[model samples]
Target chain A: MNAKDVPHQGSFRSSLYLFIILMIIWLVLTNSLKTEELLSGLIISLLLTHFLSANYRELGLPRLRLKRAANFIAYVFVLLSEIIKANFDVAYRVLHPKMPIRPGIIIIKTSLKQDIAKVILANSITLTPGTFTLDIKDDALLIHWINVKSEEEGEAAKRISERFEKYLKVVFE
Target chain B: MKKGVSIILLLILLWGVVAALSEMPFGKAKLEVAGHYTDYGKEDTGAANIVTSVVLGYRGFDTLGEVTVLFLACIGLAVVLSTLKKQGCGARQTPSLILNTGFRFLFPLILLFGTYVFMHGHLSPGGGFQGGAVIASGFVLMYLSVPKIKRLNHFVSTLFESVGGLIFLVIGLIGLKLGSQYFLNNFLPNGEFNTLLSAGIIPVIYIAIGFKVGSELSKIIDVLLEESE
Candidate 1:
């Protein structure tokens, strides 16, 4: 059987390629004329073999969604703008005497199918100022908010998820 | 037993998938920081090795957290082992002839090489963590070959780790106290670029890290070996 057909151990050629690459890297980094560093590098490379030997038999990732890539770019642009705007808004609040902190956790249930997309959405939410990723449970993100204009949790979740997840579903899931 | 091993194998396979997926463009995009290396490298606070500079200088707070992780691991090991109350396999007969002779001859050379790596870390890419691990392995070899080699003393290991932690903090604080910003370089005079003494607190800090890592790892090996025996 072909090495690729094994479904557990990756192609031997790929592993050899990686080992060579790592050896070259070690050589360049250490610049040691002595055999000791070479020996050490070989040992280290062997240790790293455990990581390379796996050929992704589980968590089968979905095919790339190219049409969604355009949407992802657009979404990212929107997200960046929103973050800048939020920063100024937060700064204004901070300087204000009221210190108006409607500090509460907002739970957002996202429709993003892929684990990768869900992670990006969660990370993006946390990246925005005045928000923190408190927990992620069952495709739902629990985010801590510094301020809330509306106490309605569902509306808040809807608004936040809409900006990020639409493009995310296309790119990752 | 077969089922348990299969479960572990399954988890490993899943992790392998994630690791491979993460290396792809989408995965890389998530991991990549938005910064130019030249711009960041020039503005880096201390040391020549960009990785070290990032870990110890720019992200000193993160380095503190990393050290805390090691500290936690050490503490956890101590706690777990303390409860076990088992003696090490110190009474096991020492390896005869071949292994003992070989270890006795190679041990010092291995130690010398480890020290060389630690000391030259700034000049090259290897740093405290990598060099210390090498040194620890040398000690491990001896422990495996010679059962009677006194287990790394718990108190000594604790002292080394604690003092290393303290020294790391003190150096950072001193830099701050002297009107340098947190983890600022040239707090101690920056020697010439390629020389052993060039990176100021970097070499000193790495040595402390080496001591901490070496002792902690040795202790870990000693504990595990003891339990096995």
Candidate 2:
């Protein structure tokens, strides 16, 4: 989805999609199938969907196919493992008497266009021990790395964002 | 000199806190009122959470006063901020793709969580005030992440706030009309324990409180954010 593709007003199809999603959330939240709960949920969901659909038109929620959704779930596990690995790496660096650490900020560009995907990539990088997102400017992110492995921007971006961005592109785009 | 005074003040406060802490016994229920509430709260209010029963059922008038205080604070903030000269659009950078996407994804989930908290007030640890704060935090996140997004309509939020307060008042009046005599009395049937529909008017009042508090706090955030802009 691009800026141009964003609807000025909510379309009927999008509104219906929002309604269904909200209704499912309401059902899960209430955790009940009683008539009153269902009735209230229906009314609330409809009202909320109507209001939010208009406001959220610019958001351009991705259309998720089952396979993509599964891929996204798999991506979460991968991100988790990476986080664990990063934790161990940080612990090792901290514990070592030599304290093998060379910290510096590096500018990296992300190819991921979707705000959500870019955020996920940035957060993933930050969560992993070596790197932290300091500031975001357009397509570039200034990241503080505990051990600056590479100085070259492209090489650094590839190393930091490539793993997550590849999957995020599939999930979001 | 200021630093020295602050340090001395901090030490004095710390000493006072320690002295107060040393007098209280640990791991013991001391308050007779607390015991009374715990033992009889569920039976009295039909709420599984005794704290919720006390806040919304027993001392509901106090909660109303607290809500009024919050409302006043928000009103005061709006009044103060409204007088400020509007700043020209500052050189705000467009947020990265990641922040925008992440906020949108989390927004609905946060809303759902907040609604769940307030809805289950009678049955669980959470309640209207907590849920409303959570919802307001979600709005704060929206402001931080997506600065250019259309603002929440003031008219709609004001309507919601007023309607919520009016509902709470109407419910209290109904309690009075039903011959309970006290405001916010449990007039409706206190259904079976632990059910969503149980707890008489507690849940209804809590929901009203939730909407009112949520809108009021969100408006406060809006005012503050706009002032900064």
Candidate 3:
């Protein structure tokens, strides 16, 4: 049933739900159920509800398709490994006497469609080593790379986006 | 039928399910991951209260962002209220003797309690965000009881928010410069465990956060009240 049809579906109900959820969170975090903890949780939940009620439409996100989700997880693992390698590489380059930083921005196209997925992809790009996602435009992410070893920037973008964006579209969109 | 409505419903359902799942035995892994700040506190930062460490130190950037959100909200409220003429501004009646007397009695004690929470955040489970809200509640009580009195000053509130935000940013920048990774601990000493002076930069940061939050919230309440009027 649509939420509007349900009784107590307004801000009051939402606040109550938020309070319970926050209380649960507080419990988990502190592993305590003291009066102070409950009071604190209620206060936090009240604040959250007040702030988030306007944006309740974005509250819950759906699960990805299993195969696609698995692929995404695998992609993340690969991405993390790549990021660690890149961090070390960057650290080495920075510490090296050569100091090899040829910083420049590059634009790369992505295949993800959903806005949420696109945002996740963009953030992922930034979270990884060396490259920062500066701007996203027309299905393309403008990235600032600390160092560009290869002349073919498009190759790097395509390779990186294709690795995750394809799976992301299946999972998130 | 609207895509937006459907999306909202889906999200609510997602949250409901996640909240339920998080209560299960397997939830520890999820909590460990989700509570990234707690992870830092437990593993590297050595702070007893994971939430305090997270709010005050690790992932402090997020806390800073949260405070900025409060500031923006206050500013937005102020803009909205400035255009409206104040009507029904004063208390309709002298607050009942009980409420006025109770508030007068409780406000100072509550304020002190809130301060205590912020000061001892590292050793215990309270911090700036929690303590700040408590202080704001005290102001709210005063506002409720003595409506004619301007409980908090807007300019002062804004000043606190800006200064608090700037201090948080400066700390981040200092961390970057010190070569101990961004938002590194031990920039100040961890201090004695149970004392108000303990937990390195934590109490200092919490105090800043408390001021920032208290001001922002009071401003929000003032604007919201004006709008209601």
Best model number under lDDT = 2
Task: Write one digit per residue (lDDT tens) for candidate 1, span A65-159.
Answer: 56766777888897899799889978988999988778887777777554345556776887788887665665677778888655566688766
**What is the CAPRI rating of model 2's predicted complex?**
acceptable
Q: Is the docking of candidate 3 incorrect, acceptable, medium or high quality?
A: incorrect
User: Model 2 Cα displacement at B117 (Å)?
Assistant: 1.2
Residue B160 in model 2: shift from native, Å?
2.2
Tens digits of per-residue lDDT, candidate 2, A115-137, equal 55666778888888889997666
* Candidate RMSDs in order: 22.7, 3.7, 24.0
Best by TM-score: 2
Please write out the lDDT profile of model 3 over residues B52-143, one tens digit for every residue.
66666666668777878887887887886787776765537555433543454445446656665665577787887888888888878877
User: Candidate 2: lDDT of B171?
Assistant: 91
Report the C-alpha displacement of residue A106, candidate 3, in angstroms. 79
- The C-alpha local distance difference test score for the whole of candidate 1 amounts to 0.66
Poorest 10 consecutive residues by lDDT, candidate 2 chain A: A1-10
TM-score of 1: 0.48
Clashes of each: 1, 6, 1
TM-score of each: 0.48, 0.84, 0.49
